[model samples]
Target: MYDEMSQLKNLLELIEEPSDINLDPEEKKAAQVERLFNMLFEEHEEHAKIVADQLNKSVEEIRSLPYSEFRKVANDLGVADSLLFKIPRLNRPRTFMSPKDKISSKLFEGVLPPGTNKAEIAMENKKSTKELSAFVSVDFDMLPNIHSSQEITAYDREVHDAIVSLYVDGENEYITNQMVYRTMTGDPTAKLTDKNRTEIDNSIRKCSMTRISIESSPQEAAVYGMQTMKYEGNLLYTKVVTGVQSGHINEWIYIMEQPILYRYATSKGQLSRTDINLLNTPVNKNAETLMLQGYLLRRIEAMKHPKYNKSYNILYDTIFKHLKIEAATSGALRKKHSKLRDTIKKILDDWIEKGFIVGYKNNSDKGKSKSLSIIIK
Candidate 1:
């Protein structure tokens, strides 16, 4: 019942208004309301009937109820306030952006080797560890004319961050490429250049084209309180529209976020927050640095207590994998690994100096494999 109501709530909130006709405010609203009921009856007949029965009314009667009346009755039906509407949480900082924790923890990586467009990364679920094939595989198929790597890059992450910010629980967004650019640049007045527009366009297409497949064992399903669970879809559903009116060109991008992510975001312990300024931070403006900071932010946000150690250890190999760094030879790999350690330490030091963290430490593990783990504090 809750799920059914939730879907209806989303429908009421996100229904589009008629744009072609010129009508008075009341007439426009009346047209929209009529269309909404028609859609509910046609597409969601079963759920609409269920809701109607809950209100002691027939489906037709419920459909004919005034929009305001239906909303009032729905609210009176004991759905939690937060589930029905957006309510500010006390613990979250106003300036922070909350993304699904899995993505923040490296579901999508920086870059893949050229000529390869698929990534089969390990899913970060404890129950699935015993299963040999538990993974979240992503494949990006780009349109012909895009020159960059087809895999999800830091630039793609920027576009993703911007698009995810627009999602309220699970609502789709209608936006322009310029809007995406502005969101990333953190400037309302930022104008999209040809380069910026092209990047945004490519990123949007790649994200939509990217297919995600999650595989888990029966044990994993039981742990998640389900008999069977599977997810396979694009990260986002994107519709690109280009129209020429009176010799003027207009382009609109419509993005529908994946439903499972919304379910996770609204569920406990599955969402994480990061400083909204990270994307536009002047300290290290490069995409690689932004990606590193994003990965670190997830660790920071996972602190169990305020006074708990604000540091954690990550295997060098894991870091390399998350950053999608590769070397052709063993000697070259050692050199790149050493260089990466120093670079990461420098980046964390800069973060501390900029007051992003109170203090920082880079403690190399003292073990037989001494350089295996980098302790970031």
Candidate 2:
């Protein structure tokens, strides 16, 4: 009798409740719009993803689309123009030109034109390493048109690093080139040779072509055999201005824009001093090496997960997802997940050997059937 009464009471309550959640289609749609509207106003990046979902598009593809598309979508949805304005412009990766400091980027991605060498691109990456603080995209599109030998990459980076240090230190740019090399990017153990001087000169010549050449005086112009240029393009011109004193020279403009500036592929991420130093350290000049180091370090530092700790059991799939997101941010030519995984494993192994990571282990060796894991000091 007690069980029968319990069942009878449950059946009465079941009849009291609504069986169909979407019985009111209008209410169901209203609820979804309400939820989406709340998300759009409350979160920036989330709003982008939500909008992308409503349009039946991937977040990456939607973010990369033209702003005009957003406007058109707004029209279709009967939403206010301010709706698009409120979301963070993920499409901002496109370049912009500032008269004070020039910048531009073409949205199109394609194979390089004939006569374009990819190695020349490696040169831009090396030079921009120090200048780019938050972001650096390694692709053919953003590099300067001027081609350079593979060897000059290190020297190009060094010169730019020194120029930035001088500006930040409140020191005059009139310092000798040799002093800049030794103090900034030179090796103390090895003596600077004639070859080093020639290399430095060559690097400077290549960098100068990125902008309009600047000449301080007629005498200095004659010394270097400066040529008058009239052709104009989107690239910024470098002009030498007199330092208001005899024998003083500053090669770059100093008025509004800071020296060692980069156009895009950089953001003010305000990375830790340790992260920045590791990325800029001269131990490895390869862009891939540095990017990998920096990217992994950032993940290891900032990740908050059930598995994250001094001894985190990071599974391969977890790493795959993280790396895919990171690769998206980098805008690499293609998604090389397998190669990237192998490269990262090798890098971590190397770091463990070098004492950069402590208490490291190979899951394969341990045979810890629980999936791969690593521990760090």
**Highest TM-score: which candidate?**
1
Candidate 1 whole-model C-alpha lDDT, 0 to 1: 0.53
Residue 220 Cα positional deviation in candidate 1, in Å, after optimal superposition: 1.5
What are the per-model numbers of colliding residue pairs?
Answer: 0, 4
Candidate 2 lDDT tens digits, 1-377? 12445433322222111222324534643443333334333434565566778889876675444545644544444443323221121111111111111111111111112222221121123334332211112222323343344222323544543444433332443333454444332222324456555455444545444332111233322333543211222122222221111212212222123442332212212222221222223343233443344445544543333444344565555544433334454346235544555566676766566555564443543642223455655
lDDT by residue for model 1 (1-377), tens: 34666644544453334361356535655565465446446655676667778778997787666655755544454332312323222121123344544533354554233333444444445544554323455665543433445566655766776666555422335567766665555445566777677677667767776766655556556667776655677767866533222223344565655434434444425655545544344433344544565655555556433544533555556666666776899889788777666666675665566556566444454632222222333
- Following a full C-alpha superposition, what root-mean-square deviation does model 1 have from the true structure? 14.0
TM, every model: 0.52, 0.27
Please identify model 2 stretches exceeding 4 Å from their true place: 1-155, 184-190, 212-257, 260-377
At residue 43, give the lDDT of candidate 1. Answer: 56
lDDT of model 1 at position 204: 74
